[model samples]
Target: MKKSNEASCHNRVSQQGIKVQLEIIKTEARGWGVRSLNSIPSGSFICAYAGELLEEKEAERRTSNDEYLFDIGNKYSDGSLWGGLSNVMPDAPSSSCGVVEDGGFTIDAVEYGNVGRFVNHSCSPNLYAQNVLYDHEDKRMPHIMLFAAENIPPLQELTYHYNYVIDQVYDSSSNIKKKSCFCGSSECTGRLY
Candidate 1:
């Protein structure tokens, strides 16, 4: 079990309901696009993920040998980054994205969960995940924040760059080279794996 916090800005359309409708698009390299579910102002949370927390070892052990797509990047003394993000376990089940050590807080229900998982990669992206520091009642634990990278219009699919740009720019090995992009945005580079 893991915990997280409230992030993302939401508009109340009705007393009983809140609606965010993001678009999905398919491109040549990056297959899916997620855009503003509505007209999103800057600094908004579209949606989030809730799931069983797994150590990198656990996540790796759980993924079958064939599921190459699940790989996140390096794991720190306490975390790992792959599949477009670092290993994030929030303090509350419903807390915003963050990491934890052996002992941290917990939450019962996951509020907005895992909407970003399906968002594919782009060399040129319309969306990005912002890392934020969350201050809590308990100062000992640290929290992380995620947000949309840019303002988006309705009906546009959301997207983020899958690879770190600095690594891409400085990496010398052909192995680390980025796969071409096919998002079909006017900026599409047209080659990806």
Candidate 2:
């Protein structure tokens, strides 16, 4: 029974891979973005955010800029956090913040990553990130899967909310600096944060 289940899982993964064909393209606003070569149905698996997996401490030390790091932490029912290779209960819920007990593990894609690296951020996005655990029970290192949140047309740029907390900075005059949002959505908040 275990073997049969494993085979079934493998087959499903293979099928998903066949349906996903994406390309990186230069955008007018965002520097680079990933686009679907074919129409993608809602709830379909797009691809995994592949990169170098690092521990919470190591990830923090290496992350000079927050450009390519993806937090994959899990939160237990008790509200405890675990990150990066740490064993987590199978029933634990995945946290969007990726906060761990100490720090948080991150997938650094700046040096090496798949097409997922080119996926730009939007306040209103057609894609959404999902924490999927397969081939392992560790939630701290679960696969960051991208899924189409709605039906996507061919050649449409695939985007998701980065959910980055915008930090307020003050100039010499003590005025707040606002970061501009280029998402171009009707519901754009005018700020990337």
- Residue lDDT tens for model 2, 14-83: 2355367888899997798999889988767788888999887786566455577786654533232222
Q: Whose TM-score is greatest here?
A: 2
- Clashing residue pairs in candidate 2 (N, C-alpha, C atoms within 3 angstroms): none
Q: TM-score each candidate.
A: 0.46, 0.73
Off by over 4 Å in 1: 1-19, 23-29, 62-113, 131-146, 164-180, 184-193
Model 1: lowest-lDDT 10 consecutive positions: 9-18
Model 1, range 1-193, lDDT digits (tens) per residue? Answer: 6443334223221121224675556654544445654886544555542334444444434433211222222222322222223322234233243343343321111222354555666666655443322334432222222345556677766666644343342122334444455566676556443
List ranges where model 2 is wrong by over 4 Å.
1-18, 76-103, 168-179
Superposing every Cα of model 1 onto the true structure, what RMSD results?
A: 10.2
TM-score of 1: 0.46
* Alpha-carbon lDDT, every model: 0.42, 0.69
User: Candidate 2: global Cα-lDDT?
Assistant: 0.69
